[model samples]
Target: MNILLYTWLGSYTDDDIERHIRGMGINCRRIEDTQVCNGDRYHNDEFCRSFEKILEDADYDCVFTTNFLPLIARVCYKKDIPYIAWSYDSPPNLASLEEMDHPTNHIFFFSKDDVEDYRSQGLDTVWHMPLAVDTDKWDAIKTAGRDIDVSLVGRLYSSTLPVLMSRMSAEQQQFFKTLTDLQLKTYDRNILKEFITDGIAQEICRTYEADEDATLRPTRKQLLYSASTYVSHLDRLLLLRVLSKKFDTHLYSTDTEADYKSMLPNVKFHGPVSYEKGMPEVFKSSKVNLCPIFRENVSGIPLRILDVCGCGSFVLSSFCPEVAEYFREGKEAVMYRSAEEAFEKVEYYLKHGDERESIARGGYERVKADFSYDDRIRRMLTQAGVLKK
Candidate 1:
């Protein structure tokens, strides 16, 4: 079967997906649909004209992308071609969620919570799928020895809470902090919505209106989004502060929302590393890689954790129930509930080299067997009805 792959700015996932589709003996045609990708998310006349022509002329079996796009789904729905999207983003994009119910679209979410949520709303197109890694690439990466003790490779996000706090009554600020603390402690799911009532949301909305600066207006959803991001930032900071005091902790990222450089005095802050060249080495070379999952994520396995395991490296990550489905705790991976557990595990695992190596090897084997890019592509295709079972 011939497939058309639509993509935008280079995601780390697209190339691997295309390669694997071809490996399955399927003709995968890629179109960089950056025109519509850059334009209106709902409708783009120029791209609609261009995309229609291509699909009609090529008569491709299905259209695929690394992440779900509403624009693509709408076009495919009209043209009568299947559109498949494998989401890597935890909750996927909020805008994309609305278009998921289109009959022609098969939208796969890495997060089970997303599928359950949309499905609860009776979205038939939603399906649960986990993120995958190109194991072959990671397995080949050679690192001399494990030197880095503890590390986190993603951002220390900036939160609007700080700015919002300036305007809120002291009680409101405390309420906001309480929400973050409660969300952080409730590891199984993101319960931000439960506590964020309409009254509270209205209060926040009114506060933004009173802002002296014209640029301070943010919608209720935006405020909630910020709250989620802030809590995640706090979660990462909590662990980083505690762990860095004891272990040789390092954070490698392109940028930061907070002043992690100054804030994390004990932790070393190396600027960004390319995913292809430097990331795998960091994974394999570290005695323990820290994956403080984004607070918004529910049961989806973050690609970072899988990538760490793909490198045959040990990981100490924030708690997520789905991780246990594929990996044996204390054998293939380590999951921690609180900041204390995370700190304690790092202390224990650092000194135990043999156990760490064994777990790493097991993790690599597990991902290679179940979560390889090839397997994920094949599964996605079969489920999307692109490939014959």
Candidate 2:
């Protein structure tokens, strides 16, 4: 099979998707087709001409890409080529779909609910094809001392946390004993305060330290409690703080290693790592992959979940109903109700490698079978009518 993957090459990592397709003995070429800056009036004259030449000469069987790019969709339409439109976000309403003039055959989405949602909105051709991970890249990593118990990957979304915390008023907290009861382990609020302090200190050190008289920026915790509700970095900070009290925690981002270490001397902080090169080591070294999100619904399962699972490492993630669609709790991956529960699960799995390995293997098998990149691309091609059944 010959395929052309129309995508943003440098955006995140699509190597897995490409590898998976090639692994199935399908020849694939990635062509960058569109740019977002074009906005509503899509125009990429150079790219369109180049893409047209590729499509005209290659005799490829399938063209898979995001439908959101209208210019590319227009090119595909002109060539009478069947194209698969991939959508990762929530499906648009009927009105929105009607506005999109391209007539794509296959619409690939992340969850079945999204498929149903699009169908309800009258999209007859939508298909459920979840995001995938590169099993080859995200494998077990090894570390020296088991220095940290919990660690998180991904950019911090700090604004959402305070809104959740402030709204949990005394009355609300008292009324919903469910959240409290779910706290299987107790967490020290002081640890959270420490996280807030460290975040502020780091910010000051990085940008404001040159001015000796500069006032300290309000800590994330203080901002959450204040009248102005949202601080985008608060969610990760809050989750980190709560987790820190329960176990030795680390924050490993692409940057901020030196600053974070200076702020929180005890907590392990490693700076930015090259995704392709550094991820494998992190997965093997860390005991538990902490996947936490403050938002619901729109908080779609991240690509890292599959990566961590593929690596044969245990994951302790925030509860999301959509997760049940891919992994079975207690069988494939662990889900936690609160920080304390998250801590306990991490500790439990760390000691019981056999059980942890069992769940890890289950997760890896599930991802390899259902969420492999090759499987997804093929499904899209088949549904798009680009490849005959």
- Model 1 per-residue lDDT at 75: 85
- Candidate 2 lDDT over 105-186, as tens digits, reads 5666665655765678676767776777767666434455334567787665324333333334454334223332222122
Clashes of each: 0, 12
lDDT of 1: 0.83
TM-score of 1: 0.94
CA displacement after TM-score superposition, residue 292 of candidate 2 (Å): 1.3
lDDT string for model 1 (266-304, tens) is 888888888987998888889999998888777889999
Give the whole-model CA lDDT for all candidates, comma-separated.
Answer: 0.83, 0.60
Provide TM-scores for the models.
Answer: 0.94, 0.70
